[model samples]
Target chain A: MRKVAVIGAGMTLFRRRLLETGKEMCFQAVQMALEEAGLELKDVDAVVSGSAPDAFDGVHMKGEYLLDGAGGVRKPYMRVFTGGGTACFSPIAGWWHVASGLADVVLVVNEEKMSSITPHPQYAFANIWDPILDRPLKPNLVWIFAMEMNRYMTVYGIEKADIARVAVKNKRNAVDHPAAQLADPNITVDDVLNSEVMAWPVQRLDISPPSDGASALVLASEDVARQVSETPVWISGVGWCIDSTMWTNRDLSFPEYLARAAQQAYGMAKIENPRKEVDVVEPYDPFDYKELHHLEGLLLADKGEAPILTREGVTQRDGELPTCPSGGLMGVGNPIAATMGIKTGEIYWQLAGKAGRRQVPGSPQVGVCQAWGDLMQFSSVMVMRA
Target chain B: MVGEEYRRWEGDMEALYVYTAGVAGDRFFREIRDNERLMGTYCPECDVTYLPPRLYCETCFSELNEWEEIPNKGRVDAITVAYVDDKGERLARPKVLAMVRFLGANGGLIHVVDLPEEDVYRGMEVEVVYLPRGLRKGSFLDILHFKAI
Candidate 1:
């Protein structure tokens, strides 16, 4: 297979409600990415569109609805949905488009218009349960996540303040991100602890806000990337894994699927020691606690020890291993699939030395980004190098 | 061995969706409700006019900038008679639905036909019938139905 690299990336401002339609948002992001790569729609050979659920957009066949703006017209176009994992999985698909020699240049666009859902976007999760079992109980995402958080805290003897620190770090880091929606430079742990409680241990501040936005990336083969970009970030590794849908049957404290996915990516990237070899990390953090949980899953920290690392400033922007320096979903906004802008997109910028204010102190040469989705069962990992 | 405990379980799901007419859709629906006219977007690159006006052309991916009022007259491209409603309940009377295509348009609209099933033919010409302006809301409902012209 041929090597693939990210030549350009772009994202729209993360917001709760944007006046622009999904098609218009996609067009804006795609336009920015094409300009950044110094390429046009006519140069792209294939297009990959990613979105979370059709219910969020209130439109059936959403991919087809937003295709024209994504520059998929008269091209080999495909839509991929793996819940939130589409954030990274779409880029993985784009990688294959170039690696398989099917296309020399590929564009991946991910969009989510959660604001289109009335009442609350969480209402869309009500339909994602097992009709015969879970649906009868009327389980929403927060209620289940609360249960998982409680279990993790109970088993690990972790403190709420330790979990709250993740929120403080990410939100503070987001102050530098131009597209962030919830960036708070002065947010504190006490504020998080004092925030309104939605479920038992889950507070309003602990969760990321649902947002409407779109993100795009341009990927090209090694030779084409070298020709288009002076500092192309190579996609050296990709991995994805999904566990059983019966979430009740698994241990909530640790995500085994994420560990497996990360292992696959680390293996392909030939990094024997993630702690020492990886310079930067961006793990999905829809909830503050998830950042720590995903850190353990990615083997960046020992199981149940991520909170300790967070407290010691090991995960800070200038710490030994900076994590979520783009502010992540917690500090930024969670538009589900559109978070590709932060996860993969941020890593590309970091490795390319273009992160400006949010850039880690060290000139990071290798980075890893991961996204989790689908009833707490799906995870996708990607490793990139400058 | 079969057990009575393994029988079927029934459940109901509750989901609500509020759809926006979008940039192009708002303009199209507003024209029908306010002026009693049908509008379509023209794509010069593809030389095609799209009904239910879109923001971009599907064939060439060009941003559609030209807007034109399309004549309501069109021929029935396809017709279907429904005796049952969405919930599978028998309707008071059989309803006729037709896909009407306009001249110089790439896509068509599917709506209820005012004519009876016997009178609705595959190539019969029809025109849009709008509700009174006082009762019209900026929605597809503003166009009451299609009638034989």
Candidate 2:
């Protein structure tokens, strides 16, 4: 297998309602990525695309529908989806394309158009349930997150304020992101606490907004990458793993799926101590507590130590190890696929010394991007170095 | 994994659906059943067309232009076989779900197959199977399945 490097990254504005269709959203992102890498559609050898659910875009066979927009028309294009974790796994698929020597340059793209659904985007989540067991309960998507948040709070004795602090940090970070849609800093723990209770332990503000957007990354072999850009971010390790869909049967206090994936990634990257080896961390944060949940999974902090690290500002931009410096999903908009792109993209920019104002205080040598999705069914981890 | 099966009591009954509004959807499935054809929208600004239809073009950030008929004869993109139902029960039988690249179309659809499961292959040619007249509905299942030519 050859070494793979990310040469470029691009995305569309994360919005609540975009006039564009899913495929077009894909094109916008893919085109930008290619242009950034000084490549063209013809240069891509394969395409990899992903989306959370066809339910969100109101289209089945979504990957096929998104083919041409992703520049896969007649190429070897395949879509990979792991519900929400798809945002991260999609890029891993691209990494493999170049790594396997089957494709010299791979185009990775993902999109979620939640606006097409009426009333509430939550209605589309009615599909994630088990038709025979859980669906009968008519549960909304928020219920699952709420239950998990409650479990975390109970197990770690973490207060809602500590979790709310993530929302504060990410949203503030989004203020510097160009495509951010929810970059509101006026948010307070009281505001989050006072927000409408969609479910127990989860208020409206503790969650990411239902958004429509797309993101893309251009990945190439080390040879192609060196020719495209002077500073290419090398993919040191890539790992994706899945747990059973029986989310209700397990303890929701920690993401075991994430732990397993991180183990594989860290093992591949040859990192004995992740806290010291990884300078930046981008753990998924679809919900506020999730950031903390994944922090533990990433071993940035011990199982129950995320709350304390977060409370002490240790996870801030200038802290010991900056996490979600790009404002994360909570602040940037939860477009599912785009969040993962931002995580990986931030590492690219940071490595290239081009993150502008959001850059960490130093030239971080290594960074990690992790995401969780499905009914806690999947987790994907990737570690990159400059 | 196959041959082994289990049937435990499932608590309640629930159904999943993907809903869409505006004329794009209404016409999307409508044309498939009415004309036994597949269609997509073209974005004049981006110079790319779409399948599964859309009300707006995401690239140029403009509303989609008129619909264009795409051939229903393309290569098989990917496929998977299912031996279980939504209840996680192994079907007494197995079924094939395929993603076919319709002719002259940018995207394809996922549907059941009329061919024997063992005979199917990726990159094989296939065409849409329209509902016989009088059975038409403005839903995705309208086409029923795509069959080998």
Candidate 3:
């Protein structure tokens, strides 16, 4: 297989609302990434666009609309959506493009404009459920999360206070992230527990707010990567999986789908023990519990043992296995697929030791980033190294 | 480039989704109407009883035909006090929604719990409340919700 590396990464500030449209945001991120890679639109061989849920953007065929803005005009622009997992999947698609010797330079751009929707983005969430079985109930998005978190808490006997620590840690860690939306250094566990109960176990602070943002990555074959980037972050492995659509059929406490994806990625990366070999970590944390949930799924933590490690500072930014130094989705804002800014982009930055203030203390050699989407069905994982 | 106020328009999506009750779903509803009892699709292959019956097993692709009688009594797995509806509109009073997990059943029911918010804690025992036989429509709404026991 041909080698591929991330030569450039760039993103826009994540916020509840942005003046720029989705197309404009796409251009902003793509332009920045191209400038950083010292390349131009003419140099790109193919393009892959990742945006999720047209319901949130209030437009049909959103991919076709944003193609020109993403610098995919007249190029092989492929729009891929696996719900929120599209960010990682975007890079995975881009990697295979170069690895297959089909495209030397593949530009992958991701964007989400949840702000375009009315009253709340949660409205778009309603359409994701099964119309016959689950839609009649009219579930709020938070309820599903609350149900999962509550089940995890019940099975592991995890205290709410211990889970609150995740929110406190990620939001505080976001203080250094320039694109962060809710980076509050003063937040505490009490603040999280005492916050508004959107759902019983899910508090306001525990959940990431919907934001409008865009992110871009430039992928190149080994030869092009050497010419374009001095510190190229190589894509070591990629994996993704989807669970049964009948969400009620499986155990909600454990993300078996995500675990399967991680297993495949680990196998490809030849990583025997992720708990020790993985130098840095960034698992999708749209909710505080998700960080711990994905950690166990990645086999970085023992089953029902992640919360304990989290409380012990093992997952801190400067701790042994610094997790989500980008403040994650909770602090950095969750723009659906555009969260590549934290997942793919953050890992690249961390592997290159360019995460700035959020950077880990030592030189990190390996890192893993994962994303989850759909009705807790789809999961994607990508392992990268310097 | 976005100016202070760009030309914008508002429109509602014009899409309608129609769903059909599958094999087990149809049979389950009919049984609920006949006996006012909950049924689970028991996958003989995997020995897992799916609460909301499905024609096929999730683990094994084998078709399931066994029907297991689910105990109407269940403990609350989770509860949420929703103050708004699907449209993001605030309700006059918060509705207590609970995930009622029946014993020996693989999946549970998500419905309104006829209890106050403070009283609807997880692990609290609850029972299914069925509507009068004359008013039953042979549908999921047959069991209005779960009531705290």
Q: Which candidate is the best by TM-score?
A: 1
RMSD of model 2, in Å?
Answer: 8.8
> In angstroms, what RMSD does candidate 1 have relative to the true structure?
2.7
Computed on C-alpha atoms, the DockQ of candidate 2 is: 0.07
Candidate 3: pairs in clash: none
Per-prediction interface RMSD in Å: 2.5, 6.3, 19.5
lDDT score, residue A40, model 3?
A: 78
How do the residues A1-386 of candidate 1 rate in per-residue lDDT, one tens digit apiece?
A: 89999999999999998867898788878888888899988889999999998988888899999888788988999999999999999999999999999999999999999988878987787877777787777677798889989989899999999999999999999999999999999999999999999997999889999999999999999889989899899999999999999888998999999999999999998989998999999999999999999999999999899999999999999999999999999988999999999999999999999998998987999999999998889999999999
- Candidate 2's residue-wise lDDT over A241-267, tens digit each? 887778878898888778889989999
Instruction: State in Å the error of residue B130, model 1.
Output: 2.0
TM-score of chain B of 2: 0.81
Per-model tally of clashing residue pairs: 0, 7, 0
Model 3: CA > 4 A from native: B1-149
lDDT (0-100) at residue A224 of candidate 2? 93
lDDT of 2: 0.82
**Residue A151 C-alpha lDDT in model 2:** 90
Clashing pairs in 2: A20-B57, A20-B58, A21-B58, B73-B103, B74-B101, B74-B102, B74-B103
Cα lDDT of model 3 by residue, A52-134, tens digit: 99888877898997786688877888999998999799999999999999999999999998877777786788778666566
User: What TM-score does chain A reach in every model?
Assistant: 0.99, 0.98, 0.99
Query: Candidate 2 chain A: minimum summed lDDT over ten consecutive residues — where?
Result: A337-346
Worst 10 residues of 1 chain A by lDDT: A132-141
In order, candidate lDDTs are 0.91, 0.82, 0.88
Candidate number of the best lDDT: 1
Residues B2-57 of candidate 3: C-alpha lDDT, one tens digit per residue: 56777554434333322234357777888888899999989876889988876555
